[model samples]
Target: MAGLIDKAKNYVAEKVANMPMPVATVTDVDLKGVGIEGINYGAKVSVDNPYTHSIPICEISYTLKSADRVIATGTIPDPGSLVGKDKTILDVPVKVPHSVLVSLARDIGSDWDIDYELHIGLTIDLPVVGNFTIPLSTKGEIKLPTLSDLWSKNPPQSSV
Candidate 1:
């Protein structure tokens, strides 16, 4: 009987050890706007208490898929910290004029899909056991508004 229980436990662990992780597309990187900025990333961790008493640190990587189907990838370690407990606002404190650059296909369109992935982790020393990434998604729209479109919303306008 004990052997059966142990086998079951081992099986469960194995299953969890190699489960499919959800992919997150970067919704936005708020840090790019301001110096010592806090990048606001949107990706909900499906599991409860992903950190579990461990400091959830993150490594951000930038990637781009051009309209021409060209794939470019670059990683930024310790780009910022995951701000908040459990899984909340993934705020990454970044340096001024961040080094990471994500250039889109200007030939196709001005819109670019910037991906800022948060890799929740305790410590790199712990190896795979400490590394954790919430299978959350990150993607959104950030279209540049025109001057008229931006100003027309406000009142107190008159032709002088």
Candidate 2:
């Protein structure tokens, strides 16, 4: 009985891990530089199920903020009806002309001592598994910035 249970757990974990996280492309960057306002953003999320089993209602939330304060928040529409071998691409758009000013700089000027990050992650529940009983683990975030730091790039000094 114990052996059967362990096998079942491993199988479950494998199935969960192998599932693909819906990926979206940040098509364009509408906002730039300090004190800049009215930013426009667009993203294309492509949903493709690599697993043999079907994924139902794959919904993801996207967040935008100047810093700690959230300016806009919305949820991506999951593919309606049964998603078979066909992959669906969702084009997402958000229009925010003004945002609450936080300490975070709006501009990425020449000094470029700024931090702009795009964090795209998935949070969903699998219908096949038990609610609360089954743990739908969340993945880590992948962060990207325009530059490392202010004085990091000095054109590589040579010591003769």
Candidate 3:
């Protein structure tokens, strides 16, 4: 009886391993906005769904790191469902406090940008497969807003 159970478990594991799952990638990460409280960065993720029906996303978990230190981490629960047989785009927002940015002055002061690594987990529920997570990661530098960008020349004036 134990042998039979072991064989069955192997069969199930093999099937799960061969199953087709959704593909996801982190397309872009950019600085979105700045506020009095903090700076907002947005990560754009594109997921391709292979199923015929919409799949519910359990949650979107993200971790933002800079200078080998975690600056922000959070999860967005029940973000939405993915479109069937198509691609869906989702935005994950990370808010970095002014204090946190100030703490990384050494890295920022040298290049006028912050080097970052973003890790995103796209979790979804499948019919027979239970929960599946697609892990995505991206590394790049986010340029800090310059004083000139904020206080630059005025908009083009049209002659009346």
Candidate 4:
């Protein structure tokens, strides 16, 4: 009886290991907006769901690091659900306080951008699998907007 149970457990493990799961990737990160208290940056994530039914996303947690220091970390609870049998695109917004930006001035002043590593965890409830998290990370530089660029968007009218 014990031998039969061991064989069944092994079979189940093998099947779970061979199952097709969701795939996720961090595609891009860029500046989203500027605010008085902080600057908002957006990260784009692309996920492909293999299941035939929609899965509810538990949460999306993220951390942004620069110069080996974590500048921002937060959790987005119950963002949304992933599309069934299709691809879903998620946009995560991160806000870095002006105080934090001042601390990273060295890197930003050197190249007008900050070198960063963005770490993200996407948690989903999968059928029979319970809760699963897809860990995604990407390293890149985030460029700060220049005065000229900002002015161009809302160019001031010449005094009449």
For this target, which candidate reaches the highest TM-score against the unseen true structure? Answer: 4
- The number of the candidate with the highest lDDT is 4
Off by over 4 Å in 1: 1-49, 68-73, 79-85, 91-128, 133-141, 144-160
Global fold similarity of model 4 (TM-score): 0.92
* Model 4 spans > 4 angstroms off: 154-160
Q: Which stretches of candidate 3 lie over 4 Å from their true place?
A: 1-9, 151-160
Superposing every Cα of model 3 onto the true structure, what RMSD results? 6.2
lDDT of 3 by residue, 1-160 (tens): 9999999999999998887899998888777777798888888899999988899999999999999999999999999999999999999998989899999999999977888888999999998889988999988888877765445443111110
Residue-wise C-alpha lDDT for candidate 2, range 8-84, written one tens digit per residue: 99998999777554333443333222224544454455555544555555555566543345555676666342255
lDDT of 3 at 22: 92
* TM-score of every candidate: 0.37, 0.46, 0.87, 0.92
Q: Decide which is better by lDDT, 3 or 4.
A: 4
Give the lowest summed-lDDT range of ten residues in model 2: 132-141
Alpha-carbon local distance difference test for all models: 0.36, 0.43, 0.86, 0.87
Off by over 4 Å in 2: 14-40, 51-54, 66-70, 76-82, 99-115, 124-160
**Candidate 1 vs 2: which has more TM-score:** 2
